[model samples]
Target: MLAGFEKSTGKPPEELSLPWKGMPDLKTGEETVEIFRSWRPHSMLFNLPNGNSMALSHEDECPLHPRSIVVVDDVYCIFLGMLLENTCDLRSHYGLSRQVTEAMVVVEAYKVLRDRTPYPPDQVVRDLQGKFAFVLFDARANTLFIARDRDGCIPLQWRMARDGSLVCSDDPNVIAEACGNCCTFFPPGCIYMSGDHPLNKIRAITWEDDEGNISSVLFQVDLFTRLRSIPRTDSSANWAGVTTVDGE
Candidate 1:
């Protein structure tokens, strides 16, 4: 997977050879955690089933870029950047107190949208006014959700390792060192999710109203990197659209 990613992105192995040398094996949770910790000693790491893991650092590496991790109910979220608008309203809507963190609000938002909202997940993301990027995992539902703000305000990149584990982070140099040329920027104005749930589920990616009428909210990036609503019956529409950006 890593090799294929590098090839498709036009990054030759020789260019990445130097960084690839003396680098710890990133496929293991232990080594990956150490690599991230080397960058931010205060970083918190969460190891998931399979070789997947998540690391978050509360310390700001860049101005206005704060990283936070919150687990509410069974949902786990790692958020980078801030919610500059509607935060108070969101807290009120979720019945959360002022003490609740913004990361907590994000998890609540996902819960509401997944379980109750009639709108599609992407629409909810589009309506958010903030410079943010996040990765959410719902343990109970066995789902994964990822999104970035529309303007690409906060940096986010992801790569699939040779062992098929997905890696994501805001630091490009770390990604380059670990994933070589395999990494690609996670597109702005986009959301990547997994599972059969209505919110992020691409399988039929539809919403049913109280009246039982179904409407589609599925979207995909075309070859031109433009986002377009896709029909439910289009089986070819897959999560590959997440990395279908123009440059990569």
Candidate 2:
């Protein structure tokens, strides 16, 4: 389970490692609370095969508790966040509510997966304006998606599991407890997808609108050996891969 602060260490809680040997098994309700009794009470636990479990807890500063973790259909997620702007435009595009809150953004995200013939596009999330980190799991597809905001204001961390699954959370200690010095912070401004179907690479393209609004869009495209024909920028070597493209 993702936790806030470690009750004993006084530091942030560790991202709980699932299926690690010797760790106590966590049940859905009472047993889960017993482990985190001294910490926050808002804990959600899901038991997996071979005694593995996933848990998530909201921190003290978060206001999206109780309703933070949601499970609809075969998709489950633990989200902690607040979108900086109203989602009227995004929701309307998806035919959702103009009054939808950021807490419900996961629902829209799920809708994209269900309605789209293929996987959702990266622009689906790149256009989102918010400060948040979430872990989403799709049971039917046996896939996992983890993402954090661009600024990294919200905390998230992860460590690899024995089966190559990512054990991630908002708490570092939870990972440390399971991985024993293997835990590290999850990178900001990125989304991680894992499953039978996965994205190969993430790319960025920049262009200008008729109104002269320079827009940068991040999305996924087919893998290529090398990108040799893109336009270059005036920036020095420090700028590296960032180049500009003219929009028609």
How close is every model to the real structure, measured as TM-score?
0.66, 0.58
Residue 118 lDDT (model 2): 56
Q: Write the per-residue lDDT of candidate 1 for residues 1-248, one digit (tens) a residue.
A: 11111222221213112322333564432444466778777667666543345777655466687777887887778888888778888789779999877788878778887785443455335445688888877766656677787677887866544433455677765666665554455666667665222322222133444765432223334444334433333233332223322221
| Weakest ten-residue segment in model 2 by summed lDDT | 239-248
User: Please, what is the whole-model Cα lDDT of each candidate in the order they appear?
Assistant: 0.56, 0.48
* Model 1, C-alpha of 56: deviation from truth (Å): 1.2
Which residue pairs in candidate 2 have backbone atoms (N, alpha carbon, C) closer than 3 angstroms, thus clashing? 1-55, 13-173, 13-174, 14-172, 14-173, 14-174, 14-175, 15-174, 15-175
Please list the residue runs of candidate 1 whose C-alpha ends up more than 4 Å from where it truly belongs after superposition.
1-31, 117-119, 196-220, 223-248
The CA-based lDDT of model 1 is what?
0.56
Judged by whole-model lDDT over C-alpha atoms, candidate 2 comes out at 0.48
TM-score between candidate 2 and the true structure: 0.58
